[model samples]
Target chain A: MKTAVSAPPARRPGGPAGRRRPGGGLSGRLGPLGVAAVAVAALLVLAALLAPVLAPYEPDIGSIVQRYLPPGPEHLLGTDQSGRDLLSRLLYGARTSLLGAAAVVVIAGVGGTLLALVATWFGGRVDAFIGRVLDLLFAFPNLLLAIIVVAVFGTGMAQATVALAMAYVPYTARVLRSVALRERRLPYVQAAELQGLSGVTVSGRHLLPNIAPQILTGAAINFGYAMIDLAALSFLGLGVQPPTADWGLMVSQGQDSLLQGYPQQSLLAGTCIVVAVAAFSVIGERLGGRAAGGRA
Target chain B: MNDDVKGTDGGVIGRAGGGSRRTAGAGGSGGSGAKGPGGAGGSGGNVIEISGLCKRFVTGRGSGRRTVDALDDVSLTVADGSCLAVVGESGSGKSTLARILVGLEAADAGEVVLAGRPVARRPRRAERRARARDIQMVFQDPNGSLNRRRTAGSAISEVLAAHHRVTGAEARRRVEELLEQVGLRPAHARSLPGELSGGQRQRVAIARALAAEPRVLVLDEAVAALDVSVQAQVLNLLSEIRRDRRLTYLFITHDLSVVRQVSEEVVVMRQGRIVERGSTTQVLDDPQHPYTRLLRDSAPRPGWRPVRAIGRDAAEVEA
Candidate 1:
């Protein structure tokens, strides 16, 4: 193209540098609910990471002599059926559920986003094919699909993580496909196309960046559901195998004790699962509000 | 900057593509246009020549399918370094003409010979890429054309990086020059599209088009969204850019007031057909066609008042 060879600026605008301003920080950008939810999530992550160090006593070492002692100062928060510290086991259990949720979010979020981008970009036979496949996946309930995946792959931490993530792909892709399709119609993308930029370049540099907030919000919401779903899976013996100190595993181990005049272990672990899921869902909604251009 | 700005001083048009980058500039600016029609015709030949271009759009589905002719065998040409303004009301096919010229929408029938190359309906990647640089476009809504993801500097520099053989530092330097050329200060380059005012955003859009060093610029109602004062400023900048760059222009606008200011030749269209074409002074001063007269009379001017249809009045209809 002979066009750009000599199209140089004949004149220059004289101006001083240092006029650029910084973007607003989180407090300025996010609403109060978002800030609070983020703070709670951060705290939960930190507590889970330091579970072994923060826990007051060894979680697995059992004492049959003082088994089933009620909430006493010497064994604060009481003891499990094996007379191990219930508080310590609950704290350690946080690690498995939280990390499992994070892994599912990452796998599902990335895979779904890519698929949505392709579907929006191609928009004909390829789009129809993806739609049909997603519809087929959607036919099964989330847990049933996950169970099938886990069954086929064989149960374990890695298998369950992948299974849950695969089960979630259809849902994530559906949500993002609408957003991506809307963005695909934007003039800037058309401008990029006219410029002869490749599909990958347009998506990476233009389309994806603009819709990233929606992706982030979707991923955040998925994290909470994923946490609850994984815990349920563990409760059914399809995830977080025994001796892993998972909250779902603890609840399952303590169910028999609930009718034996002690329900502390199950109650505490269930409370932890509820708190984490609620915190994540709140954060996701707040971010979603921002993405939707809703008022603060 | 030195690599990009060496003055031609009586050479072939001063850009690389004045010699391949037409479609690339056009592609980015033209909003998915495939390529410009042809080569950078020798400075002696007409820069753009169209013959019987036609486009039909199908509406509805199945039993309700209906085809509407968006463009009806339009033909025109412009000498190198000249401006041609195509004016019409909404649905008159003026925009469709502009779109086809830049290769954004494929024509159902007819030929577009740019710099004199016959643009294929679907060209190879390299051919389309070349056409992008040859013909760039400036859209009606400045805010819609720019990538909100990028700062103004990055937006302009991206075009240079993609088509030009310049280094990073050179590209940055050229971006500063382009910003300055469009009347944007270097300080404004880091601002995102959302942060900039409408006028400032237009300046960015113009800078992006200029980055490709285009031989032809298709401005599609580019100033339609701006306030009066800003529209004047932008119009001046466009004319100045054309003069300095020796670029050809295809100015598409419904506003006849601007046609006289920016173009040398004028083509008037009604219902997807060209009703009249001539020099700006000739067509505008003594319009031969009824459509051209309607356009001239309706255009706003000092002391002008709206004229209702005399024969279509209620009293006349009742009688």
Candidate 2:
């Protein structure tokens, strides 16, 4: 038999990335669902930012006469149990909800990115160790671990936000790690090595940028999850203190009014949470799909 | 699946480069020669010497299927500033040999002496990288070789920064010069690999390789993927670059037709072994080995057909 030289050591089936390209851009297969999700999410963010200006009344102060008022011309979205303006509170709650989620995403993203880079750099035993740690993190329910962190750190916006961020770190690290791992062995990296470039330089210069979109997509998805988790934390009174105009806090406060048939506050905040989370989730999927399409 | 071929070569080269190092038989081409400065200057003598080089790869992973003898007791020399083509069928181990030469793979046994210094079976990391500065590679796929995220000019500038420590505008200026040398316009530097055509991308790869300004280049089927016309153009560019830089080349390919265009000597490998070695003209015109004869016969020519072997098949009774 002819001595078969090692055929191309490459030639992994489905090529290196092994991705199924999303049909088209965010607007393609996602169609109207994606567009609506984006539009609603953008409006929520805008309202959240312009809360002081957009809202007709202050989110914190409430009037006895205005309390329990149904949706009316003077008080939009009606009044919460405290008689605070519902529109103002929901707008303000957007700040609390989205900002907290954004914080979690940023913290998780940076931590995960650093860990992924380190794991890929060390590889072998170090890589395995990191993989195991991430697995342990994944083993616990994100909310459960986050609650535990809040329990230890004591309940508050900062603590809950950080707790949730920590809970999501393993996920971001695992995802970014895999993408970075694939790129670490690519020929361009090897080409850089042939120039005698340092591992850190190669990672920072080449591997990181190629995988940036993947990280962004991951963070986007994490943002949605973080938002939901923070809301639950706040609903359980472990997040924003009462009278903070937080959506989760509003939900917890509005429960009693639901029994009395004045469900405007709880219903509005619940709708806001759902719309915001869904929008972020869809956006995350779209970003991830685009990155995968370009990658393959 | 659609982009598989476009991307995997670099991934493979990555694993091959950083894979475990293995000890092999002593194969250094040692004849006392001054070790001119490691990076640039040289005696313009034998830039590469391989002796008793053997590489065996175990495939099928844990199933213990078979061990592929990629290179077996291979010995060859590439004169300083000369081009030597290692020609064979796809499985003949020519690519493996190229990989070993460029420090992309470990040889189970053998010695490779580059520029009068014997390369260790496994050198220290710094030394390995230093060796990279001395010897570089131009891969088979130009698209696979370059970083898609980086502009063509920045890619070259990076090699300049990494090896020569040329920074800022100096590196930018040098990148343009290298681009021009590879027959690419200065504007081509601003474009990414995806925006460039295959031929232009190949030129970018060459420019990037030359950025290191190494003494030796291991081109593993560098021009095989190009069009016939582009192949001729790249071949000429390679020769011109060699003339200007005094670079030695280990030009590897399965195509015999282009061997004469790029190489002075040819080594024909069959089944992990060197079956024939001599001048390109001598080996192509007057072959000795039966396999060589078969290969010569097989070259596609108009009106050529497969000739029956003597006393073979159903005619065996005639013997």
Candidate 3:
């Protein structure tokens, strides 16, 4: 009995709140690089939202006479082979690119989270079945799955986005399921169960809230992956078809001008994709780090 | 071995004798009446009667699989309104017994009759809720028992709302009453589990269990995580609550000293079976089984020296 008293205290002195010493809000926890990532992401989103007002020329109505023009005062960032104002096209392209990626994240995040919650909450055979299904989904590469969907659905943004979302579901579900499994075994969950709270009630009120950080982290990371996959599909001419002013479409359409020693259009659009993907990746990684630190 | 099994009945008689020995002031309540001979069949019947409970866990697969008997034919009875301590070292299957009784784990074989109704092997939602109202559990770790996001008041009120129809202001009132009953300040209800100390958090856990107004409370190592001083305080609180409400307890712990402090009857377990059991004084003071004696001798006392003979005692007990 005295030896039991001498046993090390299982609990840390301060609770989880005390251990999470980083600043409270997202901005406060972010370092210089994370802040820059947030700034770039915010600026791109703002630019996308204000495309009509910000662009000097109509994205779709290009002047053929100005085609392949080098970067100059009249044609900022030069003109594509179709003579569409590259700056205006890129600005408008941000909108479709961002929106397509957002749609994929929302679909995959909700779908994956739901699958994870069901698998974890029911456990047993339900969990095993869902696990096998997710494993099957995981076997397909994201681009291959998206291309397959595009082929079947006849080439569209919605089809490609939905397919990529499906491909990403296994990743999110697997991560969330592992975290939720741990949370499910905690005493509070068992206490709720012992209260005879319905499975839905326990899951919604207890399980989800506890695993909210992991879900957010998963969403942030998936957002970056979704953007890249959707762009890849568009570049392949399997998504957001011609004349949509999408960055990937611009890159593909500018391929002809690249052979004419006018690389401005493809280069600018490719740079946009790289910058935007980097921004999201940085923010997502930071969020994942913070979530891990908070848990520890 | 058969004689030891018969000693359980002897424990009831010893409890009856011990009940009379209690001070008239303390025994004035239903304590004496509840311990009367044949109480098992009377109005103060066994609230929790578990028999032949068994649970096995298999690890690995096929060729490498190993089966562990977590609980092997474990049996015990807790008289209504009495505290029966289940004492053992780690892996003695005491915790398994509590889990099975609380419906958290399924037994491979056995029956658990709680408040006169045999528990369902696989209870439905309604039956689970009914069982919740009949019995509640206070776990060992205070940090893990309550949701950190929820306020202490909300945790207790949630249980009350689940087991009873009370809601809104009525629920709030009951929450406060329950918190106060567990020696927590009414203001503490607004605080989260993370904002409280280990001992205070445990009080909230106890209050949450009491909110269900359960007839039986299975406390699984309830105070093993606390400091020695806090352990005494929580133990006192548990005893007072039991006395005031006449709630039965299945106090499970590895600490023998705690067993003496909080229990009237105790069942000593070794590996998945009960090695010995009787009134607390009879078993602790005059332990008949070698394992029980080893457990008693292992507990540190004033001027007690460390002994390296545990292996010898274990071998003796095995024989």
Candidate 4:
């Protein structure tokens, strides 16, 4: 209790980076799963970018002589009904599924986050108006909305992507708006305002950073949803057209010959969708834990 | 959960009564002569006036516990450019009163007039912010008070950049100015609150309070949690700041000895009411109320050796 007459108020209790020590830290536990997902994602990207090189045989290449041959060193997972190489189509198909999902997430995350921020920040009439519009969009079943969008634009990569983005953007916007509203009331935000920050500055600088973790987690979850939606649309024939090898279209093409005992084509397509969604879900779960822990 | 250390000399300086032959000189330090323009210079009268301030929180739905009155008609006025210390124990309505002053909590019924303007019940956001800028607060528990994610310079510059419209280099320069003013080195600019010591964080908190260039500073137990040594330094810094900048202080604390050292006027509060009010010398040395006398008696006094009672009369007096 012998108080020093002139003590400075600061005491650096720990060294720099007080919250975290360097090295992998908690991410160490998540590294393998994270790496696996990332590796899959990378392979998907590479296959998409270098589809010509990675594909063992030309996707459309076939021979009546080679057709119906199953799983051999020479044939390699065999040939499809149209004499196409199943392995080549599978490799090429990863590119389409991943790229389509990425496009959908980017568009939806950015557009939805911005819309939500505006609606929440402005509040009152603006908030009510945006909320109603989003509710209207949410009223439609996600696949149904995507289908209507695909039908309107006609089937293609771009049209499929737009349909998925439009379908999920409302969900993202509504969640982000709720998050922004909560951030708007924090003492630090009030402190920010008292310092003379403009509303736009506060919303962009303060609201955005606080809501980022939530948005990122939401985006990951949405990515999984978009993959399912995109696959369904493709399955319906309003997705990536034939010649371009997409997983969903591949599944559709293989369905008719199910009774003939050639099930590998449909199985390959279904596995792609399942793996992609699982990867995103696991990574999302890990990220969500990290985000929650970081907050605490 | 924390021990209440009542050791006489822990940090209390110069016991309350009869000990200081130098006490008379110390008493004259802050008034009259100190009122000279060169001495303290900032001694305007009644900058903030509170009349019948009362606050009650209604918790639960329908029939529940009785309404808890946080402030029971608390009335006090802070002299312009002078430190007014409001001393109270825990649950004494001190923090509630402080919050009401800063507009963080709305009072149930009362009036707070700052610099002659009646405080609006619900001021417009811009006006409230401006008012907040004018009457800044320094919270206790510096670590909990600051936003953990923000860097020191960003936190300080935010106030300047946000309210003053100065950004980029100009804002950075102002942040440096504020940091330097609060006794922190410019190198602290990029450091986060978590990077700094408790004392350093408090300094940053002070720097943040000063960012708005407030005329009235409401320190809500600002130094209560610091080490005794650090508390002294912060108190001295507060004194210097008050003197140099001519800032008015609404200094709230639980330590009577701390109240004696820094504050010119002292208002003693207990259970949401001001039990005693006067100049520090008048109240501490010659308390009129029984509660004030009890507090003073309970306050620690070091270096005065207690003599063994001479007989039955002394024993009865001790009892």
lDDT of 2 by residue, B1-319 (tens): 2112211232232223212221222222322233333343332235676888999987775666799999998877665555778888788899889878877677888888876677886565676677876688888876677888677777787777767866466666787799889998776776767667778888888888888777788888989999989999999999998767767778998788889898766778877888777667778888766676677776777898866763253143222
Docking class of 3: acceptable
**DockQ of every predicted complex:** 0.25, 0.21, 0.36, 0.15
Name the candidate that leads on TM-score.
3
Q: Which candidate has the top score in DockQ? A: 3
Q: For this target, which candidate reaches the highest lDDT against the unseen true structure? A: 3
Residue A294's C-alpha lDDT in candidate 3? 68
Per model, the share of native interface contacts recovered reads 0.37, 0.40, 0.57, 0.25
What lDDT does the true structure give each of the candidates? 0.76, 0.77, 0.81, 0.73
Give the C-alpha miss distance for residue A131 in model 1, angstroms.
2.8
Residue pairs in clash, model 3? none
Worst 10 contiguous positions by lDDT, candidate 1 chain A:
A9-18
Question: Per-residue CA lDDT of candidate 1, range B220-254, in tens?
Answer: 99999999899999999999987788777889998
Worst 10 residues of 3 chain B by lDDT: B21-30
State the lDDT at A121 in candidate 2.
69
Give the alpha carbon lDDT tens digit for every residue of B85-177 in model 4.
Answer: 888667778888988887766788988877556778656677677676568888887766566666787788766754577736676777778
Segments of candidate 4 deviating more than 4 angstroms: A1-29, A56-77, A111-187, A236-244, B1-44, B51-58, B61-74, B87-93, B103-111, B163-173, B254-258, B268-276, B280-319
For candidate 3, write residues A190-268 as lDDT tens digits.
9999888999999999999888888887777778778878888988989998888898887887788888878888889
